[model samples]
Target: MKIAIHQMNSGIDPAVNRAAMDIAIRSASNQGAHFYFAPEMSLLLDRNRERGRIHIQHESTNRHIAALCDTAREAHIWVHVGSVPVLSEDGSGRFANRTLLIDPAGQIVARYDKMHLFDVDLATGESWRESNAYAGGTHPVLAQSPLGPLGLTICYDMRFPDLYSRLAKAGARAFAMPAAFTVPTGKAHWHVLLRARAIESAAFVIAAAQSGGHEDGRETYGHSLVIDPWGEILLDMGDGEGLGFVEINLSRVDEVRAQVPVHLNRRVIPPLD
Candidate 1:
């Protein structure tokens, strides 16, 4: 299926981001794309926790999500609202970095919360304590789609191999890794880790990324990538805010798995002291 990946530099405004998404969805649909995708925090990218909290909406009433759903129905195309910040499930005032998959009918087919939070102290003197404002998800989800069984993850989840391995073993043929990766880590590990995930799982890896500087003083390394099962980088939207399109061939998944037999080559290891 044809997929459109959007690389954006979103800020604190949901309206602005949704407007950008609207244009991308229509243009992508015109390009014969069956699905449209965006990066994590496509609606909000502020560093201020309280401001984000004030602006974030509950899942039932998020205007950004409503707009995207409407666009999906109108365009008759599927969309992965890469992810949006929402009120935490426990009513703790924190938020959930959640991804939603919408069908052409504008119905939400699946939702996955980001399992890993970006709590790190970068060598570049940049620090983040994502857990302060967001709660991590407890479960991994694989959503069924026309293309294949798609494994959903957001941002920091890409750094964990076990998550992807579990999903692939559960019959996922493709993985979506929507991210607003910080500049330092993105430059050091983004491509390598994504390629490794695709190679290890023998599945397609589609990562929609946020690019450039934001009003919150955060800079994301934008290189929205689409890697084939063979670990070939099919498309890379190199450090720019724009829309990228690629038609993924599902047959390649079977072809590569047959060749690699990744799931069958398992050897259990014991915990070390």
Candidate 2:
């Protein structure tokens, strides 16, 4: 299966972001890609934290996500609309970072709310407390695809290996991590962490990332990539905006698992206090 990973630089304007995504999707479709993945916050990137809350509440019916579904239907392909800010049911005015999977028929097959919150103080004199603005999810999400069972994850979830391990144990053959990663952290940990996850699970890893600078003046380390079961990066897009694509052979999963069999060689261990 050919998968296209889009390195997108989304801004505060929904119209501009949607237009850019459409062009990228059309290009990928023309190249015969069966699956397309977009970066986190693919629709709008609001710098003003206070306004984000209002925007999420009013823009519950995301035009960009709907477009992705329509594009998938037109191209007869599967599309993962990375992560978008969605309003919760309560009128308490909080949002959830959610990922939506659209099938070829333009129907939503699965939706995953990001479980991990990115609350940290960066060395660049920037601090973020996502929990203050967004609600955390409590469930793990796994979706079925033509390729195989796919485990869903968002940006900060990459730091938690237990989540990935549980998904692998649940028979996930492929994993997707769509992120709007900061340049400093991504440059230091992105490749290593992604490859480590693939090596540990022996599953194909697909990462679609935010590239370049956003309207909010935030810079991201773009290198969107697809890693094979053997931990080899099949495709990589370094910096700037572009698409990285590769033909992934699902059979390689069995071969890699057979070689290591780490999933089968597990031992019950006690947790540290």
The prediction achieving the highest lDDT against the true structure is: 1
Best by TM-score: 1
User: Where does the lowest 10-residue lDDT sum fall in candidate 1?
Assistant: 48-57
Q: Which pairs of residues have clashing backbones in candidate 2?
A: none
List, residue by residue over 24-142, the lDDT tens digit for candidate 1.
99999999999999999998889987777778878988877888999999999999988998887787877899999999999999999898888888889998898987889999999
Question: Which portions of model 1 miss their true places by more than 4 Å?
Answer: 270-273
TM-score of each: 0.97, 0.95
Model 1 scores a TM of: 0.97
Give model 2's TM-score versus the native structure: 0.95
lDDT per residue as tens, model 2, 1-273: 888999999988777888888888878889999998998888877757775555564333766677777888887888888888888655657788888888989899988889999999988897888888788878888899976999999999999999999999999999989999999999899999999999999999899999887888888889998898899999889988988789999999999999999989977788888
Q: How accurate is candidate 1 locally (lDDT)?
A: 0.91
- lDDT agreement with native, every candidate: 0.91, 0.87
